[model samples]
Target chain A: MRTSIIGIYEDEKVLMDAFNRLQSEGITIADVLSPIPLHGVWEKLKLTTRLPLATFLYGAFGAIATFGFLYWTSVVSYPLKFGGKPLNTLSFIIIMFVLTINIGTLFTFITYFIREKMYPGKKVELAVPRTTDDQFTIVIERPHNMSAEEQKKINTLLKETGAVDIIESNN
Target chain B: MYNTRVRGILIKGNKSFSDVSRDIIKPMDDKTPLWWYISAFIASALLIWGVWGFYNTITVGIGTWGLNNNVAWGWAIINFVWWIGIGHAGTAFSIFLLIVRQKWRTSINRAAEAMTIFAVMAAGLFPLIHMGRIWDGFFIFPYWNTRGPLWDNFNSPLFWDVVAISTYFMASFVFWYIGMIPDFATIRERTASAVKKKIYGVLSFGWIGNAKGWLRFETAAILLGGMAAPLVVSVHSIVSMDFAVSVVPGWHTTIFPPYFVVGAIFSGFGMVLTLMIVMRKLYRFKDYVTDGHLDAIARILTFMSLIMGTAYLTELFMAWYSGSEYELFTFMKNRVTGEYKFAYWTMLICNGMIPQLFWFKAIRKNITIVFIISIFINIGMWFERYVIVVTSLSRDFLPSSWATYEPTITEIAVYSGTMGLFILGVLMFFRFVPTIAISEVKGVLKETSTLKSFTDEN
Candidate 1:
């Protein structure tokens, strides 16, 4: 039988408990969840990338789309003329350029949604629901072949580490 | 010890969480007074009707309002200058906050930025509306043509206006939205209804308060604010161009650009004080807005009043030194003995006389008094517009063609109705958007106490 790991934590205290239990019990952890980020979770998970690249790419992409779309619309198609003037007025292009910047930069907001994987109508399981305002989550996996005694020790450690509720799910 | 010192300064205004909740949500009920709904609906209705009126104004010709070859622009142009002048506060507020390094800017920026957008909307409408032939408005732009197309004269001020206003509006929108993301997350998490939660969640874009996100947010904000400061100044100077580029006696001056910009700020600060004063009382945000904000605004008023005073003096000096009879007569008779001389002197006293009182510590510090003083400044600034437009148009190069400028009844209705629209937009905005930035103020308050900092909320 495979078991999933779940911890109910209100504060950083239980987050610490989950970490210690995960380490001490050697429970091939399925996953750990909390409402907030625990202090050393990145060290625990071993994440090694920066988000600056993601932000930069999304923002620059927005600016370009803005300029390209307007230039095509005003300069290329249906250029307006008045007072014996040409259809494509360079002065009017300022508004077009500005519209692009506003629209383009605004579109980068979609990137954040994609990066978070939190979209409308799709709900993620509450690793710890309080993560919205407070508390952090740390998820670890428990392997399939853990002995019952080993499982009991992990449970005991979880209780001692301040996990409000420790659940082993049947995966 | 530090906590005690901070607490000591915290003037305990008696308000609870529910009072805040109730005070903010006071008008939310369907049992809302008949007058409130009636007023908003009627104003909104007139606004809708006014759109048609404006449509006629454009379609029928520039002849819809009082315009002749001598005075090609009237109410539309006047209101355009007024509304654009009004748009100054949003970028100005952001700049002032950035320069002073005010952390509380987060609490107030959203509401103020909305002012920028709405005012810009009203301002932009005037120019388009004044163009009369709506379809042909694009001719104002300088573009390449099929037949040696005549471009817009870059030297013309209107071109400059087009550049400045668009830049300011775009920068303001980006700056305003970026600031809202974090707060949107808070609303998303706290909102009870699934629909609201979902809406806020979508708007928030999964902004988890990671350290990395905060750094980039800061960088983007600083960059936007930096762009906006000079942009805001440029925008007004461009609006000034529509007047300064002209050959009219009072209008033909190099000093008009900087003078108009200063007057815009002077007027903008007054409007900010006027709104905030009421807003603080209505929403019980007295503590958040603080006397400090009002005081800062007052100091700005004093400085700008002096600048405007100098601009007035400089104009008079230049007109005399140039030795032009018409220009000299316009300045001397304009304020001293012209038919519109009352308006001119009223502007002088209101913009100059009232703000001089702010140089003192006592008057500027008092909210009730400062609010009154700001109203005077607003009147002065509006009259300042009137003086510029009416005085010049009423008297020009040829004495035989000179006629007094009078706004038609339709112009009066539309102008009054535009004010109605402005108020309606502001009232609706205050309702839909959280008027005060909830998270930002909470952030300030959090420093006061040890937050439980964690919860199993779900």
Candidate 2:
């Protein structure tokens, strides 16, 4: 029920030293948050979620909405003849294509939200102000198998690495 | 080193945070002056009268305008294009500059963007007002009205205008609102009043100082910028299609789409310059809106003018070289020399001629010269549309249908009203939100090149 929380200092050398120490201690990190993306954190963390895939899917959803809405409005809604053109000119594919493209773009925005788990009304849980202005942060969720003493040791290890400060979680 | 010029140009006026807050907030124009409320009321009254005038036109028939068989597209079309053209500067400031990394945009981007929203509101109103039945304007397109009064012609470019303009509005609004959040938070922090603090605080959306919010906000900002850039381009291109897709001699040129797009930017930037000049003077944000911005925008205006010049020449060549009598006559008789010939020459002399001065650093940097030239640019853009719509329609393929175009009194007043509306939107917005993005300005200060290198060592 106890987890070994670890915080690594944002300084490049200090962060690298802490990374080596963590690997040496066999402590696996859950996630890292930096003000900006660090140079090698992606490679070190092995994070493999395809946010782009989610984005692509959301894009398709938006396109479908656009196409479906336009089609519905055209065929089912106020249908009248202009230029004596048929309801489904099929030649009008270009307009639909552009509309779908615009809509898909509109939808791709949603993926950014889902990826961050943030929305307009969602509660913001920004722990450190400097992360936006100055600092980089690395967070590792403690493993369930870790003992209370092991968790304490991990905190001590983070403190030793010049983490600046540590945030401990019950999880 | 030259690349950092825009950044340096942006941050050079190092008056502190409080100075910015005060400069941006202080009412420079005597607010208690009767004219502030009087002008607002007069503009509002004009707006009401314009709306009533439009209502009368619509209630009577589309026939109320001077638009007839010969001049089928008149003031509404002209107004639509004008509003759409005005709409361009906002996204250009909000997206294009952000992409090009012109940090100087942070100062006037908010105001220019607010202009865009109101301009769109004015622009989008025309089609519906022109539709005759304000209640059933939806019938113009096969959109959402299940009664099936008329099916939308997919081939018509106007349909695309609705889609493009609406999409642009929504995208720009998102871009505007997302950009506003951090600034809103800054305002919330700066304001002492509990009501404003609560209002802005709630709008900032529970932004607890977290790395997660920072990460998401950054992604959203960049992504929105990217989204806005394309939307801006596409919107104008779509607007251009309203003419390019047509077969009416001068209006039907393949050159029109991109040509109009460039013209939109030219005019839009001119308006932006006019605005910044006024704002910098009035709000005492002289530090934020500097001479460098005027010079840089003048350069862009010059570049756009050159593109539009080529487009004009190519259009003429294509008309002549294609060996079509109608096309040749359209260009030779009307566009170059006809009843509207004066306006055509005026456009060339203003949009095409005045911009050439921008090649000189002195004129480009000279605020007074730039301001005057931008006014000319705006006039030229309006004349450009006037030439395109009126002259093109006034004389079509059939000689029997030919007639001179003129705006009804209603048309003139409504346009004046819309301009008033546009000015009012900006004037009112400053009363609500701080003109410049203070947090963004502060953030830029922190990222000043001199300090950035040390952070790397840390």
Candidate 3:
């Protein structure tokens, strides 16, 4: 069984303070769950994301693909004269621009879901209840071999840093 | 660390995170209110009446409408444009305010976006039903087929409208749904009933508000917002092109794109004001949808109303300056002094004149007066479309082709139905969904709260 140590915080500022103190004490945090997104939490946790870059690439692909499709259908496949205007034209730009947004947003949303392992009907095992409401929780993996004295010390530190409660769970 | 010098408190009451959740989610937990049932009943009645109209339209064909050869496009087109303009408010409110980093948008954006979705859905019905043969609507799509594999006219502005509206609808829905996920997760955790929890769980897509998820979520929001910003402008511009591309005297103009976009945002803000005021009053959400928020919207409408006025005058000037007889007749004679002058003046008063009342601080502060003005703006915008469509088509280049237009009972019924549909959708949203975005309101609470120091220390 794996053990986890959780510190429940009512306030975000206190949570941030406790997070920094835990880092200074050379403790590794497994994750922080928050009701609302805590400012600067990602940077504090040394997390980086490439979702923006992915969205840009998706958008570029959509633009190119849309333009090519419009050109092929209008100019190459079934070219027809309308009021003597050119068959291959810039009128497709608006459609291409719209489709780029549509494709980019749809793909990025899917990527987010896949990366996060999220889908409809997926069971949610919350780290701590009400973390989605008003609470912030700091989770740390408790080493199996850690002495009782060390565990008590960690609990005391959390209390000093204004954690409203400390919970240890094994699953 | 809000500078009080610049703006009022966004979330009026000093609310803790738990308090924010409790306040926002309270409505969903409580018994259905009497007003909701009353409103829903009225909306359903209107919807049923509208269905009868639609049934007549589909059965009797396009001949059932007030449409003649001269004024082929009447109330259906007018209502479509009006509803679309109303639809612009949600994305415009959320995305533009988001890009500008307006913290106040947090309290109101969710409801506004919901309004957008419903309004767009309502607007979309017009073009489809207006086709006279709704089943043949697929002919507008550019797809492969055995019949010469004939593609839709890619060069047509009408085709662009199809692409634009669908893209706008899909993008707005995605953006709105993405914003709602974290909030849904909150509701999932808060609700007592097992069924509610399970339903919200699926709706939330099992969101767990981890640090990484929040980061990605915020980043995606910005990305989507960036992309959708241009969409908010493009959708209505394309809608405007449906008219502007035609060589009809008042229809053909280079000013249509920007003018339509501005008009869209103008009317959209008006609708948002109306809806938000109602929501604020009915839900007792004064702390979240504070007077300050309404003030900010009124100011925006004031500015937009000025631009609308300028666009109107510029149209007149262009018609006269270009020395085109047809343009002059459309602007000076047909619309201004001719049969549609009532609609023209009504549009001017409601859209161009009434919103200017916001310049007075007292007027903007009064919620009732503001609400009435919003309704007037809605009416005025409808008339604006009517004047543009009817006047331009009714008396064009040739007198023989000219004919006056009046909406049949069926046409009016279909419009009433859309109104019913719009109201019904909003009512359902209120009853089921969290009217205010719980997570987003909490996210801004620290910065905008009056008791910031208290929250920080707690």
Q: Which candidate is the best by lDDT?
A: 3
**Alpha-carbon shift of residue B129 in model 3 (angstroms):** 0.9
Give each prediction's root-mean-square deviation over alpha carbons: 7.3, 5.9, 3.0
Summed backbone clashes in each candidate are: 27, 11, 0
Better structure of 1 and 2 per DockQ = 2
Q: What ranking emerges by lDDT with the best candidate at the front?
A: 3, 2, 1
Candidate 2 structure quality by residue, lDDT tens digits, B292-326: 66776888888888887887788889989999999
TM-score of 1: 0.74
Best by DockQ: 3
- lDDT tens readout by residue for model 2, A48-73: 44544544565576667656765665
Deviating ranges (above 4 Å) for candidate 2: A1-53, A64-93, A105-171, B1-7, B15-42, B140-151, B447-458
The candidate with the higher lDDT, 1 or 3, is: 3
Among all windows of 10 consecutive residues in model 1 chain B, the one with the lowest summed lDDT is B1-10
Alpha-carbon TM-score of each model against the true structure = 0.74, 0.80, 0.97
Per-model lDDT: 0.64, 0.69, 0.89
Interface RMSD of each: 7.5, 5.5, 2.4
Give the top-scoring candidate (TM-score): 3
Candidate 3: tens digits of C-alpha lDDT, residues A18-86:
999988898888889998876567877888889989999999999999999998888888887776778
